[model samples]
Target: MNKAQEKPIALSIRNLVKTYGKVAAIDNVSLDIASGEFLSLLGPSGSGKSTILMAIAGFVTPDSGEILLNGQKIDALSPEKRQFGVVFQGYALFPHMSVRGNIAYPLKLRGIKGAELDAQVERTIDLVHLSALADRMPRQLSGGQQQRVALARALVFDPSVVLLDEPLSALDKKLRAELQFELRSLHQRLGTTFVNVTHDQEEAMTMSDRIVILRDGAVQQIGAPDSLYNRPSTRFVADFLGRANFLEGAVSSVNGTELKIDVKGIAVRHAKGKDAAAQGEKTLLALRPERIAVVSPDQAKTSLNRIDGSVQTSAFVGSQYVYVIDTPLGTIESQMPAFEAGPLRQPGAQVAVTWSPEAGVLVKDK
Candidate 1:
């Protein structure tokens, strides 16, 4: 299998509470991290993600809570006893130490010397593909190479878990993507629990097995990436995970599982997921830009939810052309594939946007 599976849970945090002066950095946070699972804590700045990571690493003591490692309480244990490897944004490599010495630091501290230290260091260096630069110092290596060194050092000690705090934020976009692949590959090969904290949605979605969304120092929602993206529990998650266009409406009626709502002067239909909206309740329909289709008015299908609008602007953004349409429901954004051979609509050109009822995400107005 490509993924690490069938292992037991590795860590559990119950009722974790922490405060800084009058601010609650983390409030009643509880999460279970599975063994060999890659989970990410995603949020905006000050959403308490880094605070949660620090609490897990035992670097920042919480006001109250119990942290359990493999069912044993570890709140009173120090960071060294936790045996969790940590890699931060800056890499934090020892500038005076060579790559081999850097990777061997933790082992050497435990009195592992001679051929054993060499074997361990060489093994980790091979894991990170740094054999060519094993003799280079931190200042002599590039940003990506230094990141690999940090990763190698973290893994060389064979820690029970690894906590990464914006580990790839220092690298450029292309290099970050490359490192993301290497990180995931390492996880699969080693089968170690990895907890990552980041504000970047794409990075979390790309590398994590599950994502926990946080807002204002509390849990907003937690689930698989696609589940959270397609069926967000609230407006914040739908907007933050990706670009979404909101169409406000009041619930007119609910027929069994389907919902009929009134948007502006038009009646729109949407399918409910898990929760149904009450009649007369204000709700917002969150539709993704790429989920919309722009077609000629004559060719619009009857089964699709169709809206006629004038194209306000169209801009080519790499692989897709984003079009802003001025419809009765205010402004809506639609993305069409850039390489597709079709008639390009100009500003002021009349067009129709169509999408299935399944594509409409019904989110509470709050």
Candidate 2:
């Protein structure tokens, strides 16, 4: 885990809103980004993720609320005056300029003299591991290399913060994965606060120290990757972060941190322990598919939760087997590791699906 510093806050947004006539593009939103941290704003298209990044970069002025950097208001400041480096979705490299010239442009614009400009460009090239391709033009380099060149150009000036708007979206999967590792390593080496926006969940999880999930122009949740994955707050978040089986039920009892939910005709006991549901309230339980286990019918092992169902279908997916079972409540999905030693269950086979109480997390019915 990365330890957050106790320095002054890097960026703070309070009650931010952007309305375009009849449509409220961005609703009231508040966020705090710690200094020297890597944070990712992750959401689908039109979810206001990019809008928040633009607001932070001073590209789009918010209709209301203040944009603060180190606790000083900068809402009225121009984009150049804000002094934040930006790398947009496409690698917006000038086709006419070589990689060295691209990196030197920022320093040149700042009126850095001959020797300083050369040194800064060389240093930036080394920082992005592009020393060998300094003389290569944008059109001559691969997509991954071009993206790195753009990144080098952005960081050459050593700005206080960097805003990355899906920098690796153009690369192939393998290249994207490679760049993801490089970006994380670079963030650690530079210790610069990075605010990035991406719609890819894997990218968000792989690179960010904290993730801000947005939806419908509002923040849905914000937490570390593991925290968000293990304990999602809303139905949308659970579904978006990963695959989840929704169990609709009404809470029958709440004792301390425990909950008893009635699903269909069965009263299922859940040990959400610290995440208890309100008594006599309707709730949706998020059951991760991987947490379920398929058991033999005769194995009468007493467990926290158990359902008898017929295997509706099963598919082997190399490393794991996905099974769909029709239980009394509803169709439940479970995944089991593919084993070479045994023959798995076929369609219409009767089986028992069992999970621990804590596997089912009580969430909003939204």
Q: Provide TM-scores for the models.
A: 0.95, 0.93
List candidate 1 segments past 4 Å from native: 1-6, 273-275, 301-303, 341-343
Each model's lDDT: 0.89, 0.88
Count the clashes in each prediction: 0, 0
Q: Which ten residues in a row have the lowest lDDT in candidate 1?
A: 1-10
- Model 2 per-residue lDDT tens digits across residues 126-155: 999999999988989999999999999899
Model 1: lDDT equals 0.89
Instruction: Give the per-residue Cα lDDT of candidate 2 at 218.
Output: 92
**For model 1, which pairs clash?**
none
Off by over 4 Å in 2: 5-7, 254-257, 339-344
